[model samples]
Target: MNDVNVYTVTRLTRDIRLVLEDTFQAVWVEGEVSNFTVSSAGHTYFSLKDESSLLNCVMFRGNSGRVGFTVKDGMQVLCYGRVSVYDKRGQYQLYATKMEPRGKGALQLAFEQLKEKLYKEGLFDEANKKPLPFLPMHLGVITSATGAAVRDILKVARRRFTNIKISIYPVRVQGDEAKHEIARAIEELNEYNRHIAETGGEYPVDVIIVGRGGGSLEDLWPFNEEIVAREIYASEIPVVSAVGHEIDYTISDFVADLRAPTPSAAAELVIPLKHDLTVRINEYRDRLYLSIKTKTEMLEKAVKTSRDRYVLRAPMNVFLQMRQQVDDLLRTAVSGISHSLELKQRDLGTVTGKLQALSPLAVLERGYSITFKDGRIVRDAGLLEEGDILHSRLSLGRVTSRVEHVG
Candidate 1:
């Protein structure tokens, strides 16, 4: 005789799940997200895979709803969860409690994801970008006051154009709050422009330069933020993005109306050299004078040539010819008027004969008298009543009578 013990498949799966849950109560796993989907119940399901292995994961609505951004397929992510086996399906999955992006920093991943999103939305289209002015009279700058970017920009601007007026809006260049400051600065500058336009104020800002000195990626992160990009895109004034060095590109550069290699480059591009502009203006003035002189000479030559012609040589002959033409036109006009009057007189005579044939005075002259009551002709003698007053209009005048008998 022998004693034997066996467990059902469900019991075995339950035991495995309990062991997994106990060992991996809270652990972090890194892999790329695949087959990501959200159910109608607000739960997320996906597979975490790397080159070596794959792990199925489920994030409930309570945790998934807290994720700051959308979960897309093929996104590398770090998952924090407990591992357990599903008894019904006989499979294991990571019951993820929280998840963050992997490979790239969370903020950076968010920036990249947002960049692709906005780019698809046509925010980075060349047609939507505004052109920079050739020479901006009033420039608004937004950056840190003590930074090298501002100093370089100011120095370059002063050197390039001595008369350029700059209004600097000092803000934090790098920090958690830097993006907010930059966004508000852009919005405020545009609003100030609108206010100036409404109030008819002088020296309104025409262009805006928003950036900071070169720094590390962390130092330049504010410009990569979505809020800063949105603000730069929404600025009514043209914006020149000069964040970091030429090699260092940010989201601001892609969304801005213009991108300068450096802060000094932005300044140099905004205005032309005073001496160069002066020379150009002088050259234009000289060309204008030459053109006018040549035209005037040609006109004078034409006038001289015309004076040598027969019409201008003897102006009295031209005057006599014009007078004869005018006399002919007047005679023609008088003849036309006389003919029109004769036709109108004949039509009037015909109309008068017709009118005389239908005149009420002609009927009265024929010995017929019109009797009226209340200014209406009395043709029906039966309609008349005794004692009613009647008016009999004869050929000479009207006679009033009172009807004494209806007969």
Candidate 2:
């Protein structure tokens, strides 16, 4: 053998570790944690193991605090970081950058992860959810237009409310295109809402049904997508999520305002049953008819009682009593007129006698004489001048004379 060179294992290991670290920037690993311990210097040390094998792991406080939940021993977790050697211990360990619980199936894991992100962003909050309209005149449906779900909803809605209008925006319900189409439909509906509100036009849709027919997890995977969930959450109109079977829940269902068990159930929920409504209307009509009949009967009875009253039924008796009262008043009025005439005659006789007593003729009969001048009675003797015309009057006649001498 040529000269054999002895080299320390540590030097070879160091070189190999540097090469691996440079080659692999970062990676993700999933396992249950063990021998988890934290130092006062804010460093964590743990062993990650599956049934087959185990690897040492380390997470610093800076990265650990970013995890929402507590990390404990035996807790299955997926950690993302790089593998590097600990120089002192001469062992390789994971330097964890992020960590989350593992062992949940792929769908469940994605659902949880998206849910946690949206919850942190306040997208899935109850306060953001809108109230469904009590009576929707027009329902906008975002699903495959030709699918069985559309037919079911239309059949149920039309059978329940014949006048209800349904506008279907057809879109792919699965595969890569489903999420984008669903999101676009939601945005279009919101835009329609704004347009109607601005133009003061009738709202084209009152509630929205965003769903598809039942299928397996992979078939209904679009509804579980984060984009579709966020779009449903951000919609202004109330969304009724009807995706997958009743037992299957997607992210859209969690964030929607209401979740329907199926497409038929969603239709039934959005409208009323015509037969039940007709029954209620008939009951109301019967009650109204009875109320009116009762009121009319009472009014007729009142009118009949008034017709049978003494004043209306005994007109002859009423007339006889009124005529007797009028005759009695006439007799009393005649007696009062005769008595007043007799008193007036006596007053006239007395007044005539008093008038005769105060007459000038009566004074003449007592021998009183009168003098006159110029066809007038002389009031003063001095008024009579010599050669003035004079007149005299007796009780029965008058005399005309000329004055010739003073008195």
Candidate 3:
């Protein structure tokens, strides 16, 4: 009993924490995530467990940011952390620094997660896409300047169209910092376009080629980044994503306005064949010339037919005929006017004869007189009254008198 030493609880807990951490420093654990939760302080707490065993894990705020994925319940994960005991709870737990989904590549999982996020935000919608110019005068290319992608694209573009202009925006296509470079290249090129528009310049880059040659998924990861996808979406110029061979695709492919199978294909699509354009233009010219010739021939034939008419062949004779028609119209109008005046004079004479025949003057001229009493004609002897005023009208004079008797 005397040989036993007494120990405090705090000291024992601290010693256990240190010993556990030292023993399993930088351990790798693979299990299914259970009861995953993030604390208010940005620490992720979860249980990593298989069928028979369970281990508690925590990722502090500093390490959580670097995990690069959301921790969820029922997710199979591989984690790397230091094993240590939590002194307060007197329990051993894993302090994880890194974690990834099990049975899948971490970068691929990242790509999928980002893709879902952007898709929900409508970044990949067709309505948001811009159409490529049918014949772009200038094309902006964003890739490694020294890469085979640039070489293939230039060769194809030059072969397809003789007068096409290409502006190369050199950028790294892979590695940790490649995504930022690609994004900046996109923005810078867009800015250049804006500058051109503001300046009222012609032949600015009408389309952009954003891609690289075929490679492993790791090599093409920059194109799959969220920044690159958004840059392509927000660009004013149409973008063509040609990241790799036909079998491979990236997030850029989904967001770009068009996706070509290869860089060379992108070049071919941007500019049509020079020979085809020439053939089309020649066809239009030939049609126009043929139509004009046919119309001219018809007009000439019509003029010839017109000259064969008698009036057109004898121009002076036609004028003489029109003069004769005018003289005939004048003679007819004068005769009509004279006949109308004669008829009016005859009517006036007839009316005058009738008025003279009905006139009372004629009767007075024949030695007849009219007697009036009280302004009324005395047509009967009974109409006369003694001492009434009377008037007599003769052919040349009027007589005033008083009625003295009746006869």
Best by TM-score: 3
Residue-level lDDT of model 2, residues 1-407, one tens digit each, is 26877557889779868986997558899899899898998888898999999999889989875564556788888889989888778888889988878865545566667778778988778888888876788899999988899999998987899887889999999887888999999989989999999999895678999899988887788887877888888788899999867897888888899989888898988887878878999999999999999999999999999999998999899999999999999999999999999999999999989998998778877777577665577888787787787666677676667777766
Model 1: per-residue Cα lDDT over 297-356, one tens digit each: 999999999989999789999999999999999999999999999999999999999998
Residue pairs of candidate 1 with colliding backbone atoms: none
Worst 10 residues of 1 by lDDT: 102-111
Give all TM-scores, in the order shown: 0.60, 0.52, 0.78
Models ranked on TM-score? 3, 1, 2
Residue 267, model 3: Cα distance from true site in angstroms: 1.0
Of 1 and 3, the candidate ranking higher by TM-score: 3
lDDT for each candidate structure: 0.91, 0.85, 0.91
Model 2 regions lying over 4 Å from their true place:
1-102, 113-131, 303-407
Residue 316, candidate 1: Cα error in Å is 5.2
If both were scored by TM-score, which would come out higher, candidate 1 or candidate 2?
1
**In angstroms, how far off is 178's CA in candidate 2?**
2.4
